[model samples]
Target: MLLTPFARVIPLPETIMRCRYSVVAACLIASFAATAEQESIERLEVQGDFRRLSVQTIAGSIAVVSEQDMQRSSAQHLDDVLSQLANINFAAGASRGRFVQVRGIGERSEFIDVINPSVGVLIDGIDYSGLGISSIAHAEQLEVFRGPEATRFGTNAMAGMLNLSSKQPDFRRDGAFSATVANYNSWQLSGMLSDAISDQVAFSLTADKQVSDGFIENTYLHRKDTNDIDELTIRGRLLYRHSDQLQWQLIAHAIEQNNGYDAFSLDRNRTTLSDEPGKDKLSSQALALRSDYHGIVGADLMWQLSWLSADSDYRFDEDWAFVGIRPGWEYSAFDRYQRSREQWTLDYRLVSDDQGRIADNTDWVLGFYVSGRELDLQRTRRSGTRLRAFDNNLQRDNAAVYGETSTALSEQTTLVIGGRLERYKDDYRDNGNLTIQQRHSMWGGKLSLNFQASEQAMIYTLLSRGYKVGGVNGEALSRAGDDGLEALLQQATFEPETLVNAEFGVKGAAIDGSLVTRVAVFHMWRDDMQVKGWLNPELGPEFAGFIDNAGRGRNYGIEMENRLVLHPSFTLHVSAGLLKSKLGPYVTQAGLDMTGRDQAHAPRFTYQLAGDWFLSEQLTLQASVQGKSGFYYSDGHNARSASSELVNLRLNYQLEQWQFAFWSRNALNQDRGVRGFYFGNDPRDEYAPHTYEQWGEPRRFGVTASYQF
Candidate 1:
């Protein structure tokens, strides 16, 4: 795949055919109304649930973004594309955002713990949930599977899963080169080449490097790069086929990021006053190999092996101020944390052959999965003339056995059932006299019924269950000086949480494929719901954070995605999410009653309306308007971010195989917040509490040029 700033006219893969039927479908209007065109919307194949199926056959809420959809705009990272989707958002406190929230449930940050992500992230068949990905270099597709997926993935996918795939080697040689220059002293260069090395072998390689001065200005240091963005991603892949019954795939990727993190401002804007700005640095390498063979009687076998090694150093100013700001009374300090992590995974599966059904008309699959992780964490702090160090070692192991079966009850209906039994264990030890071990055995499953109403419409209902692993807080508890706070020690350990979800969805198209749409409504109940709780920040690092179970929780939402091919030259796309999330009877240690209140980071509504205008064979214009309602920033406080809307525009021109693009994101230049806090950092008012927000990107325009060969 090449990073061209234009979409290619490609054929749909595994799409539902046109059907002269009607279903009660409601679509949100994005722009002007249009007339039907002769062109049809493109369809995508989904690689979830251990099967390659179309959207109509998948029994859940799913969103797919292609290389063309991503490269058409100023979308460099996952966060840039999340807002265009429904009911998805991320928390940003690093070079790239770390926490990915689905339906208002997920971790907001990871400071003192090796937290288990509720939403799992897979990049090129390897798990990268421990760290955030900075770029999507030469990615072919991005798929977001919403709701519970415990039957397929164990604890890592309690909320959902995100799969990012890079382009594989093509049969024929193809490659591209791309470059871009934008505001804030930002520039990027990328190149890719792929070809067949032999009749049965093919290879692909891509490299991307992007650097920026960022969007922050430090007044004290007289520098504008206190918050910067610098990243490089290199990807390589190989595919080998011996015959129709066997194949092999190998993938490797490496990423390096050296970015600044002085984003907090005493003025609460894009300007800062930190004398010693912090840094965010990361280096990661990963490899994965997979093979499939059909030698077993009536069954096929598949296996995969993957490993990842990463090193990260995240540091930030503790005071958010300069030394002279408060003279001798200022709190001047730096907090830095470093981690080295290694992870490996192995998966094996057996599936019934295409012609081999277990029963009358049932297809079955069985799988076994196992993974292990080792992490070393180090924290160094400097306060004036004092320096303190802390070190910890963490280990985690997991194993699971899963199986699924699908049976055709009738020509128009099918029933699917799946289940998984998993075991998780965690061990932690630190130099500060804290040793903890925890283990859990859990199970999850799903039952789904599919009705193929027509060639272009499918209706399904699903009931699924998911679970999340539980672990102790090593950083905070390590500081627990054996003071009689045995009660706090008892709270240090929490239990695993589970989610049961029910969903009903319909996928269909009408008017000769001019109107393609999908709507899904889901409701989920959380039992022993896990939530991040704090003892007291003022009590030092010892009582900083812990995990607790809220007796109960509820999240329900409706998501819809629609494409209207009003005319051959113009198309309109709209995606929206309406959500209602509530925490059970739970009160914070600070006596903040949050029962019945909306969950943090859970917006009531999110929407995007976009349109494409093809003026000529060589020119195209795209525009979009995205908006989100305000929501609580944290559970400890009532501070919230304001509702905001953004407008984006892009114009592309194509000449043969060369392309040019003019793009601007947030063209309206709204001062929106990506993250916020309610804690006090002001010394002038004796550390009074106030809301501080990390403002989003400002208006910026850029030009991109690419050559495809």
Candidate 2:
């Protein structure tokens, strides 16, 4: 299906796409014919919380993808893992998805201005928000905590949080190496090593490199590597047992991505006509230090310090064709944006010990957080005989203090409350003689009540609030308005946005601990919602972007994650998200009312069902079905993506010290869209509006081999 403003009439063959359903049904029936002994499901732990708790004790949705799951599914990148989860979506305006959205909220992309991410990303305590770091070489688990985590993570986690933990040294001598060869001229090599240097010190190191000639072909330039992928990641860690009363750990990480960025085309297909194909490149390094002290009287003391530095260069061809290809009908232009970013964060916390409780059967925690960031950006544009450059810099600081307390009202009931007080300040400057200063005081809190209905089931209710700081709206506010221009210039900033969430959940196990499930329903209200809009594109860059506050918005959704151990060697998993959203009351600078429309990149439904079957002691098979409903591409345009469906499979075999796996993703070879834009960019049609799209990955097959020692 095609969705456009002027013309929205196009379709792909239904028969070809519908075959995935038949394949799924056949696999399900086949699994039922084979059986093994009953298996007992074990409870997983939540690592990002202030307190150590089981999955069934959480009041909201939490999804954890372990190393075992990644190995069986061949999930080489972070994007691959996100696609298998529920209530989550990512936007890929660049070479890969750097911006993430959870529960119908978050930023899609950033070109000229800085963004405050709604969904936060942290790997081994180093923040990677708004940066796409694809390699997951030695990750132990990826945890997705849905809903507002304001008390725990602050404003950056208004929508949710993605916490990735790396494998720690257990004072053991172990190692592994893996290699893979896949279609699309793709190949990868990764390895991990762990060793104890001394009785008091241990270390673990990981490194990975993946390269692929991406799927797009530049027809005009006769090149197939225009949209290629080249990424490398390395991580090193050291653990020190300072004394029996204290422990310390240090980690260092580095990432380099030199991926090409020539995806969009006039024909809106894999073939492109760009002569000046550009690149999306990044170089980043991070350091993190953590300490845990058990000698602090009646409480356990924990603190972490992390620092990150990144330099990125993103550029693209403004004109998607070679010079003189359309002669007088075309213009030759290229645009680039370069950024240098540095940030550091410190977090300190004290968790109550068994004997530290202020009252009987009660627990408490206190934490303090501080962060500082500096960002510099430069934009270079070359069009026709004109060239221009713009530079800007931003510095921001944040500080917060938070506390949480859990009281057992009775044997079957518990009450939990948490709150935080935060302060934010920023200074902005530009070479264009623009300067702005802003300060804000924000607060957030949560209240949850849990009832242990029975040994196998628990019910809970939660209420939470989250806040995001405001910033300057240079592009939109700088433009001259009618009678409102004077009033707008007086307040050239967009106010901060806030969200209040209410959730109810039930966690239970059935079939004698063989089945475990978590279900949650949440409704969120957005006040003074900050959203991205567009000005008239015909006016060019000086007046292209718009940022403002929408009065009110609402997002409500239901999420479920279930695991069933049908037999000792067979486990089935199902997850889904159903969403409904409205944009609230607002009109764009282009005079378009977006009051009750669905948010951008927000699909109505997403689902995944997977089955793992061990055919024998040495052989296993994994299959899954994943898909999402249709959704709009952006806030200012009507261009939307067609619903998509895919099927994935993997087969594994093992021998002494050696293992081999064959995998296929999107086996049905369906043509689906991942990014879309409705704009007037074509020269032949005199720049008439047209809907354009960037396609997702095609059918892929790969084989991997690994040796463990």
Candidate 3:
């Protein structure tokens, strides 16, 4: 069968129709306040699980997709699905997908939080931290929490946090697997098995392999490098129910991936690097232990300890002539990074099982946390006789003590408050072989009031402070003749970045359980911002910039998330955001005015709309459309990249013991551009195009099958 260009595009007629209906429905409800039935139905919320509900309450600016949603959605990667959420964007240079940015904050060739991510990520309760934005395989759910949620998840949660949980054994001793072949010579095979090893223990294993012919072209080069990706993962868990009073669990996970970096195409909107591709590899191991005990006094105690180690190797030689061969310079870089991070937490809480007043009418929790990390970042670059080596070794020791208490002001109101005192110490070593020590301490607190407005509605207001520690740099050093050791000690000093956030929110369920809505307004202030910049020749081309206490930023925004259960067979989910980020006065190498510029990658407005329809008990269809307003790509702030939108669709069939589905992504094939700098004889003309590969998956059609026993 011959296929037309449009054959690859997913149909969005239903998506448009549903959007129109949503607008109409919202307007009708606003105009007919007297319709009590309409009002009740308009307040229905879509979250259906208790554990998920807990996550939502504290992980503000969060979005959750259930396992069922993953199965019904046609997405090749988690980021492909996440791009539909608000304020999230992906930048693929040439042919490689390298970084994930949330609220305009994260970017680094290596994963050490050099830019201090405003976003954080957790997979299966383990902090899946890294510099390059990679994808996860066989995930059960992806929980995204936007904004600085340091109080709960800690520092890196500055921009936001993503938590991924794999599916656990269901104790049914069931397993299934499937394979598929699609366009671009893409092939994938995946399967999993679960069974009880003993009366009190169970084990499960899942694995998959995938390969794809990348999309892009490099006229000067015969072979393209960025289009290949490979991954392997294994997870094991054991549960021991010692008794009603004591229970414990241990989990282990390991993963390895060899991913190509197409990053960008020779032409805009293309990523198929006809020449050589960049190489990126990531390997990680993690172990976690969790224990819980119920005391005689009705108190619950929980302890958790986790250890993780990850190593990443990246090699890129994008130049046709190793160096100085063409009108433009050839560039190549290699980086190796190793991170070992450990965390220990203890929590003890006293509670009254019955709602009737406790002996003290109070509930409390005591907690202590400690985390230590070792990071080694090293990179080597060679361009036309210029061989430069850079390395930074950073060690961090962190500890904190926290306490929270809650009291019922009345049957309809509750007040909660908590505080954490944290200390951070760092040891740094640079390429010149110089060493320096840095230390910092601070406190964060949260206060909130929750009011039950009625049986179906509630309102809450919260205020909190967040902090991120800073580190030293390797580029600044006065070299001694031999050993490349430093002659003078110019201590690299960076201060901590801090923010105070205040928010007010209202949540309600109405419209006969057909609709759910939540609205929140927030304001935040950040100080001592350590903005990032590129290297310039006049500044030596090797010198990185660090602006100390370079003014501040003010962020104010509104968020709305709603799910409309219009009918048992048809459901609609809609979310919208309006955000404003303003940078304060800061100095650049050229003394450029960096004030009032949108924080590097921060976007102003974002939204997502989706619908699910059951054509029959055996067949279902789903569609989603999402977009971001637009954002700046560079620190000097030269250009404003345009915003893009994506549309996706999926169809599924259910049978007694098997399931099958097909889906398409990036149906419109939109072009995404990034901001970069070109260093040459003319410094003023330094600005050049660093166009990114269009995120469009071209057009993909595949069938997936799974079974349960």
Candidate 4:
């Protein structure tokens, strides 16, 4: 396979090149003058490598992004970091980067009903699955497993898994603080400190706060902060080494967000007419304990226990504007939703030690997982002075046992197999005072063969199966009319969805580690695919949405990633993904045929190119170009977003113990849409349908200063 040429290229300033050469020449002379300190400097280089480049491959397709990479990109959110990866997309809703879609699978909304997300997310081993607001200010590493991780993560990982590891306390005393000021009246303050409390104990703490006057402007209210943001995050960790072979860590973290959510407008621009813009708020906390023991005979044992609690409020102006915009329309409303969730999880695992002969030839692991979750939801709608409300409660319990083993059959060949058996149950109750219960048992697994073609390359193939549990539509049933309440209850229940996927890929490091590349091709078949649909409520004019088992679907894609170290001071990175999707012949309950249509949010192509140049020991420059081909927004509607391209840049300077950086996002100021919908939101049009879009961020630049001690 050959590399594809970049879509566009812009030339750099000649003056910038001259400045770089001058700095490089001065640095070379300083290097020659410090020959006696070469060994000490080399030691420092190796220590930095341990901190920034240490990586472990979990599965064939898993990718790990280091902390240094995150800092280099100046990523304030997960989407900022993942936007540069291959085969990844995000569905931005009323808030920021909420739902993530990977390899053309995942959901876009969870407004009216509870959903089982295809992608799983974990922060320090505590599940934050569908929530996307956790701060990454002190994260050490991010691992993305880009396949069905059923054997390890169970149902929630039917598509993939995202794991975030926070920085840990070490036997070194260090601290750092940073402040950033950017456009749109945005500023951030963050700091972290770590110290060794004793010979066997260490402690670390991190805190950060971010504030921004958002992009959108409310024309009616003459306000620019209607969609603003304010967020805070804090975390603490304690590590204890009980003995040479045993260690344990305790972690606690909290996050608070108060953000406005006025994203839509009738004109599809960055200005809105809403007079009563709503707010999005969240308060979340988590605690976790992990222990590792290496003293077991020929095996290592690990245990983890975690608890998470979250409270969220999401509201919006039901009407884009107050009445009087149209002659005959005089209607206004407000909608508010409050939700709280609590979850507890426990996991235990054992793996063979690699020191023994059997372990050297074979790798094996076994694990058990158990979790329980509870959720309470309340919704209120107001029209004039009239108000209507609904409340619901949901509970879920899950347990699974899984195992995997790989053995070397020959010098160049290896075979791997893994499987998981899971049991899940759900209970729900709504304002109608009726209770619904459901239970499911599922099996998922994977099989693969890996071949080491040469010292510098390897090729592999895999087949995997995964499933998503089903649930009853309690809220929809509660709103059912009296004529067929029984029949509607039965019709509202949905079955589980299953997927079978096959993939082939090759990865290699060439030119003595100066260049690295990975490519993968995959095909997936879905059975009884779960889909969301909107319809008229049985008893009201308000529309309602629910999950259903649509017919089958198929998806296929190719992804490629490459990194080239052209010189000691220059590096380049490229990634590209191509996808195709189709739905089998199926008719929705609303009498619409979605056959032959692409899956929602599944873009046909996504690509990114990035370059980094180090002018001298104190100066660095980075630039990136990212683009995505557009796709449909829903199965029931024909609305589509246009393809978009964006450019970003960052420059950094270091002097002794202090660093200064300047960064710009969306430097091109492209007008792109991250989300879209085709529906009637205004009553003045007599419910006539039209397209609306939520625009992406505009061009913004910022400066940062940091100090280390």
- TM of each candidate vs. truth: 0.93, 0.92, 0.83, 0.89
- Please provide, for model 2 over 398-465, each residue's C-alpha lDDT reduced to its tens digit, 9 standing for 90 to 100: 99999999888999898999999899998988776889899999988899888776655677778889
lDDT of 1: 0.81
Per-residue CA lDDT of model 3 for 1-709, tens digit only, reads 0111212332222322233333334333422322336443321122311112443233245667665555544655665666666666655542344456665555523332344445656665666655332444455667666566555556766666777766565456867676666666677777777777766666666666767765544444554435566666677667766777887778778777777655443344553332445666777778888776764454566666778888776655533222233334334333333333344333222323334234556566566777777777666655445666667777787787776666789887878777777787888886676788988887776787776655555566677777777766444342222232232123245577877776656565553666666655566677876666443434222323332445687666666777778888999988887667768777555567888777766678888888999999999898887777777666653556678677777887889777777777666665545433333321123323343323445556667766655
* Residue 415's lDDT in candidate 3: 84
Tens-digit lDDT track of model 1 for 325-394: 8765567788899999999999899988776786669999999999999999899988788887889898
Q: Which pairs clash in model 4?
A: none
1-709: candidate 4 lDDT, tens digit per residue? 1111101121222322323333233323323333322221111011111012222112346666776677766877786887787778888776687787778788887664778888878887889887774577867777776768788788988888788877789789888999999999999999989999999999889899989989999989999998988999988889999998999999998999999999998767999989889898989999999898999887788888999999999998877786666656546789898989999999888877776326578878788999999988898888778887888888999999998887898997888889999999999888877788999899999988876655445666778898888876755675566333333454577888888877766665552445666666667788888877655423222555667777798877777776777898998988888778877676655567888788888888999899999999999999998898988887766789899888889999999999999999889899887788777766566766777888878998999898988
Say which prediction, candidate 1 or candidate 3, comes out ahead on lDDT. Answer: 1
Residue-level error in angstroms, candidate 1, position 110? 0.6
Looking at model 4, report the run of 10 residues with the lowest lDDT sum: 41-50
lDDT against the true structure, per candidate, is: 0.81, 0.81, 0.59, 0.77
Ranking by lDDT: 2, 1, 4, 3
Q: Pick the candidate with the highest TM-score.
A: 1
Write down the TM-score for model 2.
0.92
Clashes of 3: 47
